[model samples]
Target: MAGQGSGGNVIAAICNIFFPGLGQLVQGRILAALIFAILFFGGAALWFLIVPAIIAGIVYIWAIIDAAKYKGP
Candidate 1:
């Protein structure tokens, strides 16, 4: 249903906003989620700025799109 799709999109957006890979985790994409989390957080640590946030924003949009496209569990 559209509602379910939207809900997933919201969750994905939230996850991507707070931390990369979170959306994937919610989607049961454990490996991908972990990879994204490490890469994003690691980059933040190395850069010492908001670069990760910017990257996360992009990823968040991607996640939302993916969530909207989700067809099943």
Candidate 2:
């Protein structure tokens, strides 16, 4: 709410740590939340494959960083 590095962003980042895209949802970014959730969870669901698992891990980290650095539009 107060741009990147704000307390809200920190909290959002922490939320994303627990659940990918949850931070976006908390920030009222429905589309972003859906996109990240789908990407991360979908990839996670296919974790039997090495590539998908790696992709999901990357997505999970990216989601945290995205939430932390997001500046509201």
Candidate 3:
């Protein structure tokens, strides 16, 4: 059971890796998905600035880690 659960987490993490918030959507976290997508894309749009790039990277990494650990509220 532990392995199975971890497998699911790995899958979700992979999904989020490709696209921010995708794992949240897959996990049925609609609000989180929307929020993450918005923050991710918004930050990405500001990529011309070095700060936004760093911020976006941070948010993107957070999204991935969050999606992996999310257990539904």
Candidate 4:
């Protein structure tokens, strides 16, 4: 994928808006994708606790930013 600020990053960010970690998957970041997916989903699963729901929201936003700002090595 292209470096940060590229079209790919924009698309990735948009993808992440729909589902956490999807952007990373699109970028071929399997590990990051798995981690984000797990963290977000896990937190979301505990929504009844409130705190976990907040954490999930944070994770979701972070995933979008991470994907958008990712600079390929």
Which numbered prediction scores highest in lDDT against the true structure? 4
Q: Tens digits of per-residue lDDT for model 4 on 1-73? A: 7699999999999999999999999999999999999999999999999999999999999999999999998
Which parts of model 4 are misplaced by more than 4 Å?
A: none
lDDT of each: 0.65, 0.95, 0.80, 0.96
Please give, for residues 1-73, the per-residue lDDT of candidate 3 as tens digits. Answer: 1332577667777899999989878777889888888888888998998787788888899988987776654
Query: What is candidate 1's lDDT per residue for 1-73, written digit by digit as tens?
Result: 3445577657775776666777777777788677777766666565556787677555556654655455555
Model 2, 10-71: lDDT tens digits are 99999999999999999999999999999999999999998988999999999999999999
Better model by lDDT: candidate 3 vs candidate 4:
4
State each model's C-alpha RMSD to the native.
3.8, 0.6, 2.6, 0.7
Error of 4 at 50 (Å): 0.9
lDDT of 1 at 56: 56
* Highest TM-score against the true fold, candidate: 2
Candidate 4, residue 68: CA error in Å? 0.4
lDDT comparing candidate 2 with the true structure: 0.95
